[model samples]
Target: MSKVLYIKANIKKEGESRTFKVADSFIEEYKKNNPEDEIVVLDLYKENIDFLRPEDLGGIFGPKDETSKHHPILKYAYQFADADKYIIAAPMWNLSIPAILKAYIDYISVTGITFKYTEKGPVGLLKNKKAVHIVSRGGEYNNTPYEMGDRYLRTILGFFGIQEVETIAIENVDVMGVDLEEKMEDGIKRAQLIAQKF
Candidate 1:
């Protein structure tokens, strides 16, 4: 069965977040299309992920220090290594990704774990995976100067060996206000259709 790992960065559950509805819609359709696949959802808002420490950096460099073996960093590295595909859902914050998503990336982006440097240069260890990013923005920002979140996300994921990344952005969310009802409907339909294709 295909394994899909979903990482959610939205802090709010439902009413507080306008972007969460879009993520829910995409996940519903994705699950419907690929019923046989295993979907693992990680709500970053709820999870207690360890922050990067100096020891974590030491562990990545093949630390001969025996204490590093029992570090929580190894568990994170293993979780990332096990995923076959990735789905990240978040709201654009300050023209960049949410802090939770950034924290998750920092946790898994270990030197020897996700990638390594050979004489030839840096090489990604994680392989054969694709990523789908669901981004919700308050303003219309795609292909604009403000669209740094998607570019940064894609670049970081690519560095981990997940080259094929598709982003579905729901823009003008906050700007639309109560008129957002129609926009949400349209965004859900578009995201669902894309998930079906994915």
Candidate 2:
């Protein structure tokens, strides 16, 4: 049974966050598909970590010992580095992810732990892991540069040696004349398919 880390980055309630609901649908199907797998959920809103604070340096310097580590940088980094798979669910705010989600990323992107620089260049430590991003966007920007959330997540995960990354995007959700329910259903349906194959 593999360990799957589910990161919920939205502040909205369970049913209010489109991305969260889609991810939950995906997890529901994932659990059905892989009954033995372990799923861990980390809600960013309730998680208090000063990710933007410059004084917190455990992530960059790497934890010296678990006994001495008192901050969330090592805690979040270890959780991420130890996971076999990841599920990041969030919505695009101002053409990017919410600040809390970005902060969570900062907490997890630990140097010499998640990734390291060698003579050849930076190398990802956990090459065997996989990741999936379930995001909801108000506008359509799937293949465009405006999709900063997807692009940044892909890049950072790739930097950590997770080469297998998938995205389930619910685009044109608000601005376009598309029905929210229909778009959400389609996203959930797609998530089910990915869950089976993942």
Candidate 3:
């Protein structure tokens, strides 16, 4: 069966941020069609993925030392490599993703694990995977060249050998004098449609 890793990076766990709700719509549709597919939800807010220590760095570069076993950095890399597909959801912060999401990427981007260096150039180690980046932006700029959230996400996933990457963005989150109900409905509708095809 296929395995999908749903990475939820919403620092706002169950509040005004609509990124999680958007991601859930996609997952709901996907689950309807592929009931047997395993869904692994990585809630970064609730997890304990610490940074690398001096001892852990030595073990990562060389043989497994006493400190490597408990390294918070290694688990994310293993989980990232194991997934056949990925669904990442994050809200736009300052025209980009939040720091928690960036930290998650940092934890998983281990050298010689997710990617490797070759004689010709660098090559990604993980293979045959697809990724969907779901971003929530506060303003509408779909056609503009300044859409940093989706672009940066696609680029980073591509660097990890995930070529089949797609994005579903919900913009205009903070438009002037707009009805909150209508905005949410529009976002949910768009998200549901993308979920059907995703």
Report lDDT per candidate. 0.80, 0.86, 0.78
Residue 126, model 1, lDDT: 76
Pairs that clash in candidate 1: none
Residue-level lDDT tens digits of model 3 in 94-126: 877777788778777777778877898788877
CA displacement after TM-score superposition, residue 92 of candidate 1 (Å): 0.3
Worst 10 residues of 1 by lDDT: 61-70
Worst 10 residues of 3 by lDDT: 62-71
- Model 3's alpha-carbon lDDT is 0.78
| lDDT (Cα, tens digit) per residue for candidate 1, span 62-99 | 64344644566665566776788888888899999988
Worst 10 residues of 2 by lDDT: 62-71
Can you give the lDDT of residue 6 in candidate 3? 95
- Candidate 2's TM-score reads 0.93
The number of the candidate with the highest lDDT is 2
